[model samples]
Target: MNKTPLNHWHREHGAKMIDFGGWEMPVSYEGILAEHHGVRQACGLFDICHMGEIEIKGAGAWEMIQSLTSNDVRRLADGQAQYSLLMNSDGYAIDDILVYRRSADHVLLCVNAANTEKDLAHLLAHARPDAQIIDLSADTALLALQGPASVDVLRRLGVELNSVPRFHTLDIAVAGVPVLFSRTGYTGEAGCELFFPAAHAVKVWELLLAAGADAHCRPIGLAARDTLRLEMGYVLYGHELSESITPLEAGLEWVIRWDAGDFLGKSHLQAQKQAGLGRQVVGLKLLEKGIPREGMNVVAADQPVGRVLSGTLSPMLQQGIATALIDRAVLSGASEFFVDIRGKMKKAQIIKPPFIQRG
Candidate 1:
């Protein structure tokens, strides 16, 4: 199994480690509920070095990227980032990615850890000779500092991010180490994602924890991370998003640049749009006492309508919340559904997500 630079620290600190996509990652530190609530009420730090980064540089870099991704790369200015998707020819997602425009001729793609090699190969297979596509994952380390009091922690560390807008990047030095600091995060909070040299991982990790001590920030792990993102209705690669699911079906058509020129899967997506969506992803909150889990069947009028893609008992709501891919027709008129938990049907109500909205 693969190990991130912070693996030793996690083990030493008593984090319950588990295998996540072939990498040994921490599932939780103190506990999932504690970590989840900590981020909500105060702040939390996360070691995200397991994620992947790819650099596309030189002439035609923007053009190459634009042709490959669902979002409009041409719209991005330097130091800006856009949430986009790489689609296969069938208009289904290869992976959801963050496209960071470093310069006119250079772009950085932050990809999911599991799809690093697949995404790289997809880029290289269609590489333009003038555009250089390089994998930078092995050399980079990523850390996320998130939640309400995150800004206070950054200020204490001497990194004043008052001027850095969300979804934007700034090259800054923290604790004497240079980092590509971006006002971005997976958890729905005002936070930053810092990308720096692999060798500086431990230094940055320790510095963040020390600086954030007063803000009540603690190390969070994958379990809480999952619950946090799920609460925000964020799509996970294998769950809400997959090669078998199209962006339109996942309610992510907003990311598609219909006015922008041709891109991979554009034609197929256009056809799908014309035909209308047969299914859609929607949020569900259990009305009765029960927790929903993935692969559980969703029923409407006693017939299976869909299956739960991601589900958990929300720490804030104290109720079961989930995202499911169900028939679009059912959502249009149905106000309620049932998720088969074990052998019993649990009642649920359809709700638009960001289930627990933060100020």
Candidate 2:
């Protein structure tokens, strides 16, 4: 398994390690529950070095990126970012990505760790003669400082974040280390994602933890990260999305730009939209005392309607919550359903997600 720059620190701190997307990463340190609550109540630091970063530059960069991603890149100005998807010809998701526009001639893509190589290859295969694509994953290390007190913690390190807007990037120095800092996160909290040279990972990690000591910022792990994102109804690449699933079916139509002329899967997505959808993704909250798991069958009126894609006992709500892709016909009439768990049916109610709402 591949190891991040902070692997030795995690081992020394007695973090329970696990293999995630071919990288050996911490699942927890104090515990998942503690770390999960830490981020929600105060702040938490995360080593996200394993995620991939690709840079596209040249005169043709804008045209190439506009044709590849579903979101309208023309809407992004320098130092801004937008969430987007790479789709195949059949309207299926190739991968969901973050497009960071540095300029009309330059853009950066932050891709899922597991799909880095595949995403890179996809970009290379479609490369235009004037565009140059480079894989910067190996040289870049990402760190996330998240929660309500995250800004205060950064202030302690002499980094003022008041000037940077959310979803925007700022080139700044944190404790003397130059970084590309963005006011963005997966935990649905006020925070920032810091990208810097891989060599400074250990130094930056320790610095943030020390500076955040008074605010109770602990080093979070992959397990807590999963729960945090799941609580917000954010789609995981393999679970809520895959090569077989299209963005339309995943309840991600908001990410698509109809006015953006001619993308890779535009025709197929248009056809699917015009024909109407057969299935739709929705949230489920268990009324009983059982946690839902992926692939569990969802039934209504003794008929199977869908299958759970992602589920967990929400740490904040203390209830079982999940996201499922169900038959669209059932959504109009059925507000409740049953999840078959170990041959027993558990009652669940359908609701719009971001299960735990925040201000």
Model 1 over residues 1-359: C-alpha lDDT tens digits? 98999999999999999999999999999999999999999999999899999999999899999999999988889999999998778888899999999999999999999999999999999999889998999899999999989989999867666679889999989878899999999889889999999999999999899988999999999999999999999999989889887898888999999999999999999999999999989999999988999999999988899999999999999999999999988887766699999989999998889898876
For candidate 1, list the clashing residue pairs, or say none: none
Model 2: worst 10 consecutive residues (lDDT sum): 156-165
* Reference-based lDDT, each prediction: 0.93, 0.92
**Model 2, range 166-228, lDDT digits (tens) per residue?**
889988887788999988899999899999999999999999999999999999999999999
- Which ranges of candidate 1 are over 4 A from the true structure? none
Backbone clash numbers for all candidates listed: 0, 0
